[model samples]
Target: MFARVAQEDFSQQALYDELCAHDQRSRAGAIVTFTGRVRDYNHAGAIDGIELEYYPGMTEQALAQLIDKAVKRFSLTNAGIVHRVGRLANHEQIVWVGTCAAHRQDAFLAASFLMDMLKQSVPIWKKEWVGEQAHWVAAKGSDDDAAMRWLTEDKDS
Candidate 1:
């Protein structure tokens, strides 16, 4: 498992390659990855950029717990998550979540689980710049709704 809060940019290809290598060594048959980028627009208006902040040790610990939860819940062979903090320009990558499993379903669900949990539970805060003003984003109803699914009884039941 890998989890880290980074201040520098990350390469999706490089990270994917590393995950693939690790999965191959571990005999994982499926892998899934998600990368989130700083969008150019949001509810306010055209976003110039965003400034992210977090409590260093606390943020890392939260992420590690998230990855561990994902791996155990989905029976994943391995997982990795990298989230960028500090000032980020529009269209720059902000987060990456990857999972490896013996089956595709496990890998997909684990990746989805990690992202939903990140949105719901991560310690990072964002200050988005919209033109001349900055606004701190509030938790969204949609995100909460999405995350609630995982907390409920199994869907097929």
Candidate 2:
């Protein structure tokens, strides 16, 4: 199976429903989901909103490849990823990932792998509105470390 990537408005219920529907169609025994939300604060303090930027086709392609790797590595039955673009308010959802597999371990690992890879490899960038100023948020080194662990595991295996 291949990966799926979508740019959408911040909507938790919609994503939850989509995930539930995907899970229902599966013969797998387990499903795992991860949702990322816009927080009220950042390193700069209170945040009013955030604007996400991406390279359109390139971003989607990169995300799809990341998901494909996760699916293959973990033997996932199904996977869905949705990332919100444009301006988003505090407490709104920013991203979601769902994975279905025959066992809990595969489902869990796939879901984690998708998120970690997205954070590290995906080209989507964010500009945050904090009070009167806006700034671009840099990708965290910790995220890269997390993603690299999987690569190391793959090399070892």
Q: Give candidate 2 regions above 4 Å deviation.
A: 1-26, 154-157
Q: Write the per-residue lDDT of candidate 2 for residues 1-157, one digit (tens) a residue.
A: 3333445554657665676676576688887888888888876578898988888888888878877887777877777788878888897878878888889988888888888778888888899997777899988889889888877785223
Q: For candidate 1, what is the lDDT?
A: 0.89
* Model 1 residue 141 CA deviation in Å: 0.6
lDDT of 1 at 101: 92
Per residue, candidate 1 scores C-alpha lDDT tens digits across 79-136 of 9999999999999999999999999988998888889879889899998997778889
- The C-alpha local distance difference test score for the whole of candidate 2 amounts to 0.77
lDDT of 1 at 50: 94
Please state the error at residue 34 of candidate 2 in Å: 1.0
Give me the runs in candidate 1 sitting further than 4 Å from their true place: 155-157
lDDT of each: 0.89, 0.77
- Please give the range of 10 consecutive residues that has the lowest summed lDDT in model 1: 148-157
Clashes within 3 Å, all models in order = 0, 0
